[model samples]
Target: MTDDLPVLRGLLASGAPLTWVFTGDSITHGLIHTRGARNYVDHLHELIRGDAGRVQDTVVNTAITGWRADLILGDFARRVTHWRPDVVTLMIGTNDCTTQWLDPVIEVTAFAASITEVVRRARDDGGIPVLQTPPTVDLHHAPDRARIGEFAQAVREVAAREGVILVDQHAAFTAFSEGTGPGNDDMAWGLLDDAFHPNAAGHALLALGWADALGFDAVSSPVRTDLAARVAVARHPQWPPA
Candidate 1:
């Protein structure tokens, strides 16, 4: 048994390149930004490169706007098979929770099963699977917390049972937004204009949470000069106050 443990550790520590596949909805798709590069997936790439010092990591974002779990499962093999990622991060279920068509519990269960299947398939290819619970939306406006919470719990249960890592962004974001943690509510200013999709601040939070989950230190590099200029422009008003 002692030898077996070292053998397993050796297999896991072989220093292979890591490909991270991020799948979800519009938030994962990086909407409402001037460039197509303001989503959490992009931020995650930046953090990994900055901290890991030339790791062989690639992030493929396959999150389409308004997509539900069923839709994602239908296309999984075709879309996700080729990359053979080292880690796959899945954040879904918000849209499914919004639907009144299916039983919430059943929908969530089926979603969990579908996601588990994907993780298992990735395992067959030597990939690590991670689950990210959907973030809490401004439920006061739409008020789907009960259903969303159920779905989030289901995801967490699956992660635990499967021994996969789960990043509970739902809990993290709520704590941050409600003034209970290190989150910046003002950061939600333009990012969560509709409360569903996040702006830059929301993406930043995602990046930070992902870094924590991956056991990596937070990114310490100076912000890109061009990005800083854009952020500065966003902070200041236009000339003559259009």
Candidate 2:
């Protein structure tokens, strides 16, 4: 999270009501494995409301499972502009990076274009767009993790060109997985519900990133780590029944 995003800074300082639209794929939806509540969007909404003195916000999740960037594009008009969101976070690209279904180059290129259009639409509709790099995938199943990086870079480039806030969730997940920074520990494995969809702990990481980007004081680092640990331990397959 950087301090240079004037648009986001303005949004935070206004202290007015805000409608936040989160659009992405399964990860954003946090489906079957997470039961929805544990996803980052939900956690972020909760954190926003917890701070009584902060901005009053309405968070809406319009993400669908197994959808690509094109599909999301089709719904943007109806799902986003129609709702008139104040802030929009777009976090797609996982399905777009699939190795088997489509041409990687074609898919990624389309993805980038779609994301750029999404940002444009959001801004045109009087909303500030926050572009998020997709979280890293499990290397075991996703051998072409490099493709993921390419897609993430595309998001970064789009954010730079569009002058919108960019949250580097991919980097955050990598750091968390590697345990490289201060208070960072090995929490990546437990973060995943499977090879793809992130579990509760994983979503917390995303929530923290978004919170940090928005300059919110909610959910401290230690708290996030503890929460991840709790989720991992409680849900570990070998744990005895209560």
Q: Candidates' TM-scores? A: 0.75, 0.82
Clashes of 2: 0
Question: Could you tally the backbone clashes for each prediction?
Answer: 1, 0
Give the clashing residue pairs of candidate 1, or none: 191-199
lDDT for each candidate structure: 0.65, 0.73
lDDT of 2 by residue, 143-235 (tens): 654488889999998888767789998887776545333332433565677666787777877777877787764434444555556544633
lDDT (0-100) at residue 219 of candidate 1?
38
TM-score, candidate 2, is 0.82
Model 1 lDDT, full chain set:
0.65
TM-score of 1: 0.75
Candidate 2 stretches greater than 4 Å from native: 1-4, 35-37, 52-56, 103-105, 144-146, 179-187, 218-242
Query: How displaced is residue 76 in candidate 2, in Å?
Result: 1.1
| RMSD to true structure for each model, in Å | 6.1, 4.7
